[model samples]
Target: MSTAPSVTDRPRRGRRPAAQLVGIALAYFMVLLDTTVLAVAEPSIMISLHTGVAGVGWATTAYTTALASALVLGGGLADRLGAYPVFVVGVVGFGAASVACALSPALAYLLVFRALLGLFAAAIIPSSLALIAALYPDPGARGRAISAWAAISGAAMAAGPVVGGWLIAVDDWHAVFVINAPTALAVLVLCRTPITTTRRLRALSWLPHLGLAATLTTGTLAITRAGHRSWPEAVLFGLVALGLAYGTAAVDRTSSAPLVPASLRRDRAVWTAFAWGAAVNYALTTVLFSVPLLLHATATAAGATLLPMTLLVALNPPATGRLVAAHGPLRPIRMGFVAFPVGLALVAAGTAAHGRPLVLGLGLLLCGLGVSWTLPALVGFAVQHAAPDAAGSVGGILNATRQAGATVAAAVAGAVLTQDRGSGTAAVPFLIAAAVCALGLAGATTRHLSRTKEAPVADHVAEARHLGHMSRTSDGSSGELPGD
Candidate 1:
């Protein structure tokens, strides 16, 4: 087990290591940009591939389903392997996959490569955060870095449409995939810093992992088919999906080595965070998927339309940093639960009211506020409370829920809006999103109220407390850096 350094031995910890932080942030930025940029590009993809909405929906489903399915396993890998090596492999593999995607000749080829992208992405996501945990061993430093890292997502969120539009204008749908290649290389170079090596003999259950992946993928396909109004196919796939989920759970129940650790399975905060994450991404993915399609927007026009919401995404983090410093993480999260539903409802109203720009813009603004307020804070909250060695595992689980939300929203939006591509159908998704957020709000509030102590308070105080608590871990390893 590691212990904190003495006052004399304490590392300066004055500032975040910029190169590593930027590399970590940029890796996630590329991932988010890929998602956001592709939202507008979906129309272009449909046109280029000579496919209808359902085909386009499958393309997205293939990637997100692969991601959600593989993340927990990825987390385990990050623990067994060192974070740095796992992260490097992910970056290299992601770049190669991006190149393969750019070269694909048909939708089938593209779908295969897209799944590869998600697979490599699974490696990157958990390990990158674990790298952050190692890089900033001080909870105080790590919290700020985590916030900054998450905030950078707003830049990607904001840029996705504009960048996608610009690239589409310059070439076509392939440019979006091609851009990732260079970005991946840059991440590799920037993230070359040597840090602590954390390894664990974490148990991995492949059968359960495969079962969960199948469950999500088949369920997604069910939603995709149901969106096209193929009730028979939907029912078949849905039943299969349910069967897979049940089987996976049963296997997990009896397994000597469960896919997820029992400690994580028993954590109330983790479960609540999972639900909350799902709610946030459901609203987000719905908007990203539907608006451009319903409005019949070109890339540039879609960028302008989404700007109001995306801009708010960028603006929220810095303020959230201060808000987190003062009022604590829960306030922003509560505020977000309120803002998300209202914004979604307004977006639904705007879509129903003849695609009114004013209403849509206002609604998007609220959605942005909701995202900015909640997501970074949530990241900080989860990471702050976790055991250092389990950082990757926690990151994986939290992101798995978030990605699961994205996958479900994409499927739901595809099913709902793809059916008609009409203003009426557009309103249905936002309405549904609002209801989901309301449930999240209720759950989160209930959790806060039931707890006796506001233990997950501001990072500075929490960090000090955590340092005192885990100065030496069970393994008796030092949670310290060379100097810092």
Candidate 2:
């Protein structure tokens, strides 16, 4: 077994440790909470907005698309500027947009503002991860911090429904989003100390990234509108296809600052990690978005109450996440891989049985557990292998994969689930999720996770030998202890 660097001499200085973790964690919690609350409130939004399936779907997709497209830029900008200021901007902007979403009079207005929210919210994850990377310079400490970070996010996902449900039950659907404002403001108030930092120009171009976003946006619109007979729909589909093709070409030609970093693209471990992370997020988002709708649709169709269905869907996230932490990411992820299909099968069986809420909830819980398990591991792997100077770039790419993957999944699942206009559509998304989880499992079994233990400990010396790679490759240069 390769030994890690000596623990006593790792770099651990310049920032208050608890402050870094607390500030970043609070920021992350708000993001996760917003996503979860929105997921459960989808049914309420559709009813309140008097919109069709497309309108409800856009509520989630808008945030994800904006978030994914902006993440890399957010990270690079943070590096160029400073994390604290950028982070505060993201917080205040997201909080302000939450108000916009809450007070909007029309679906269009809400979506426009939601997109704005996503743009600013995009800064949070990359900034938080980069801050953590800067603050905790030791690998072991960083890993543990990430694990805690993941745990907090998982907890938030679990709590989303309870809070959303309470608000939707007692107050209004808009209140679900409105709650973010005060919480974010409080976090911002606490984070007033600005760290002095300068922005660095990344070698990559933004055109390819823009192309990638255009591809996803257009592709979603194409898939969603596939059933329409209108000439406008056809034009949209054609445009989407063109954008996808253009994005593909752009990625192939660019070596510097492509949507995906060259390091991630070139490294199998990193690339595989990216693919798995995308797949997991895609499946998770599909479930989060679709399951509530399925339950409500079933309850409404059958003239049953909505409470039972809501409760069951709500339980899956936190419950499964806690299970994942206990069992380790692999077992839960594998189980999630296996369990997702089981949940889907239950959904299929339940839908066939005319909206059995218990079965549906059980299925969702299984899927949620699987997602929580897989996501942390993928994130952990990406951060673990990143080159020192490239932490922001790596974090951005990984987060982009997550947001984009979830966006794609949400789009495809929406397309699939909206077809029948019945609760049976629930089975469609569940099936797709099952397929995604299976793909994740197949990828997991490949050499990636197993190879982690065997990676060279002499990587620091090897990295030092490479051109332009000599600055602080590993710990021990600053006389600070690891895990301090």
How high is the lDDT of residue 126 in model 1?
Answer: 67
Q: Over all chains combined, what TM-score does candidate 1 have? A: 0.84
Question: Model 1, range 1-484, lDDT digits (tens) per residue?
Answer: 1123211222222243788789877887787678777878888888888887767777777777778778777766766766678888988898899889888888999889888888888887767667777778776787677667756644777788899888888888899999999999999878766545556665666887788779888998898888877899999999999999999988987775565555666666666766777678777888887777776767888878898888777655666656766666677788988999999998888777764889989998999888777765665555555555555355456666777787888788778877786667769988898899899788768845347244554544443322211111000111222112
Residue-level error in angstroms, candidate 2, position 17: 6.7
Each model's backbone clash number = 11, 4
In the range 1-484, model 2's lDDT, one tens digit per residue, is: 0112222222233446666566667777777778767766777787788986667777778888888777767766665555657888889998899999999899999989988888888776556665666666667676667556545544454466667777777667888788889878777655555543334444435766577667777877886776343458957676866868576656746635556544455667667767776776776676667666765542222212223323332334334334433443344456656766676677666654654668765665565455544554444445446655444355456666777777877777666666664755557776777787788788767776665553333442222111111001000001111122
Best by TM-score, which number?
1
Give lDDT: candidate 1, residue 312: 73
